[model samples]
Each structure stands twice: as C-alpha cells, then as structure tokens.
Target: MRTLAPVALAAFACVAPCAANPALDALVAAYPDHLAGYESNDLIFRDGTRLPIDDGVKGKSFEQLLDAPDIKDQFAIPYPLGTANLRQPAFNEDPGRIRNQAMFVKMYGDCRKGEVKAQMKAVPWLPSRGGGTVMVTTANGVADQLAKVSRDLEQLPKEMTQYMVPSSGTFNCRVIAGTKRLSVHAYGAAIDLNAKFGDYWQWSKPKGGTLAWKNRIPLEIVEVFERHGFIWGGKWYHYDSFHFEYRPELIALARQGWPK
Candidate 1:
C-alpha cells in the first residue's frame, strides 16, 4: 500500500450549495404525488412534465410575480417565521405568495371544473373551544396535519383562542381580489381564522402606496400552524394575518429540524 499523505482543506472548499434550497427541496419532497424531482434546470413532475426553475426574467416587478409567475418564481422570497414585530418587508418579501397558476391548478385541480371539491375533507376547528368545522384538502396528508394543528392549538391559553376560533371561512372557489389568479383558498388548502381581530393589508390605506405592516394574530397560534407545515400570510408584505395555507417550503426553512 502506498503511504497516505495528510490532506489540507481549502477555505473555499465547502459542500456545494444546492441550486434549489432545502425549503424548495422540502416542498418538492412533501408533494411526491404531484412532483417528481428537479432536473438540472427544471422541476420534473410525476407525469413527466417539466417546469423551468426560472422564468428567465430578471428583476421582475412585484406585480409581475403576483399576476403571472413561472414555476420557479415561487421561491423568490424567503418567508420569515415565528413572532417578530412587523417591519416593512423587503420590496418583494412575499414568500409562499407567488404561486404558479399551472402548478397549483395541476396539483389541486381547477375549481371551475368541479375538480377541487372532490378532494376536500372537513376538519373540525378548535372543537374543544366550540369552533365549528372547516374544509381543507385531503391531498398530501394536509387534512391530517391540520387536525394535529387544531389539537395542539386548542390547548393554548384562552387569550389566544379568540384569534383561532370562529374562522372566517375555507374552500371558497374564487379568484384573489382584483386578480384572475385563484386564491389558495380555492384549493381548500388554506384557512382564515377570526376576521374580526385580524389585520389585512387591503383593509388599510397607505399614505403613498405603501401600507404599514400590522399583525394581531398571536405568535403562539402562528407557531402552531407553522409547526404543522402551514405558512402564515402575515409574513407577506401584503400581510393577511388570519390566513394560513399549506406551504411546507416556507415552514421547513424557518423552523429547525422539520420532518422531511
């Protein structure tokens, strides 16, 4: 055997950073039924369809991503999780908010075609707190995960219960306000908690096209939802505090040691 030589590590030598992040990786992994894996430059679907990782447009305006996003544009912003006071988010810190219409419609089905309702299952919301039932997708174990979230949230202090009970609604087959894009609520994978106490960006008037960020949803409630793989809308620059949708990508990166 030849004598082994000591090896010196270079400062620049490090594990190759994934072209796609762990957050994006978890998103793909979480939905194996819909996604296959990433090819060198695209997301491969189980059906052999490939979606490009980037739309090839640089410095897209916020309106561009909201109105029409390429599949990879969904990962443009990092979602901040847990309770941090509202600061004006960076120009486009709308994480989990840039949804690709084709990808969502393919996975969740088009509500207009009567395809979405078929996959929905009713989950009782804060049953112990006397909250009524809400509907969500049964796909990818979302309903089961939400049920777990409900169980844990019910055990929180009474003060926080006000924000969680009397949910505004779920499973609405409608476009997002002022836009043709389907709301995540249309997929039955999103939930809106109490509306009375929640803050919405649209409801407030901005002095000069920039609305002040505000939040009323308790951090405990947000933590419970994030723990169960749901991402809060309050984290968005266009914040909607009561909204929580099934977005494992945002939660996976923000929370440590999330299950794969």
Candidate 2:
C-alpha cells in the first residue's frame, strides 16, 4: 500500500526556513546536510564554503543566463507548481533551466574528477516491471527518494509501466550536448525516463527561432516524481519530457506562491 501522497509536498511550504530570499531558504532546507544558511551576499555551506548569491552582472541575455548565471539566477524564472499551472511557456521561460554550475559542483562534486561516482548507488527502478536499476547519488537522500519514486510508479496502472521502465539512463559523466555545462545526470541526480514516449524540444527543430513544446509523458508519472522532489523538464519552454532532476527548492517556492 502506498502511504505517501503527492499532497505531502505542501509541507515544503509550511516548514521552510525563513530568510530574505525564499529560494535560498528552500535550498538550505532541501539539503540540510550540505547547506548551512545564506549570508548577505553568499550561500554558506556546512563545510564553510561561501558562494556568492549574485554575480553582480545585469541585463544578461538568455544565452548568458544559461552559460553564466549566479546562484540566485536559478529563481529568475519561477517554476509553475502542478498540473494546474501547466501551460505553453513564453519565449525562453525555462524555470529550473538556469542552473548555478559552481553551486552544484560544490555540493555534488565534479564527475570529471570522479568525485561524484564515489557517492553513486543503484536505486531499484520499477522493480515489478522488470526495469532493473539505475545509479543515483546518495547525497541529500536522492537515492531514497528515487526508490520512493519507483514504488509510487509501480502503483500506477500496469499499462503505464511501458512508459517508465528501461530508463533512458542516469549518472552520465557528461555535459549536456553542445554545452560545457555539466548535466544534472553528471552529478548522478537526474533521471531520463523511457525515450520511446518522450519528447524534446531539440528533436522538434521548429522553423525560425521558435520552440514548439511537445510532451508525451503522462502527468501522472510527472506528479509522482514531483512528490519526491524532482522537477520535470516537460514544464520548460525547451521541453525535454524525458528529463527529471532533483530541484526541491523550486518546488518549495512554487508552493509558497512565489514568482508573482
């Protein structure tokens, strides 16, 4: 019997640590063991590492934000919370797309240097469906949460299992294609679902400089991952329906009714 309900995500808002920047507060609370708190202009870690919250650069283009964004830039585009808020995003409105590479590196360690693999452990993936396993980081209870994701996924109708089993892959020590920035998979904290039913903006290649968002992954599967602190790429303007990554901060902020 499944004991965890998606509604339990509401607790992310109810008990987040209060601070000037709610994003930072959610970030600290999400990974309690890795983060301490934020100072006036820096995010302080439990290991005494202080990373600047802002890069002091203004008016950065979309590409600039993608390539070189500060920690706070992660919250520049607010992530819409649930199936209720799903919509066709405006141009370049990619919430959870702008990442702070340095920040992730600080906590998850660099995969190139083989620091991330040391924390990698296999999580059961759709056991009842013969999905086998995928490697994920043990950091911040990610492995545990993914295990929960697997359990919840199994509870869905058996036919839905076809879309989830045989994961695309996880824990890849590589950068996102055509970019120097490391993928969340490089940190062993992202999962790509079965590609047969997935859709990605990159594959669409729409005419002109426009993006046509497409998604075949069911919202039911997405909601299960969200309940366990994963954000779906289907929500992004540059949608990659197969991608789901750990980013509990955005989830918490959305529950707090932010990005207004």
Instruction: Give each model's whole-structure lDDT.
Output: 0.78, 0.86
Encode model 1's per-residue lDDT on 61-176: one tens digit a residue. Answer: 88998887887677667677776554667655788889998888888999999999999998988998988888988977889999999999988998888888799988999999
Clashing pairs in 2: none
lDDT of 2 at 152: 95
RMSD of 2: 6.8
- Say which candidate scores most in TM-score: 2
Candidate 2 C-alpha error for residue 109, in Å:
0.8
Question: Which 10 consecutive residues of model 2 have the lowest summed lDDT?
Answer: 1-10
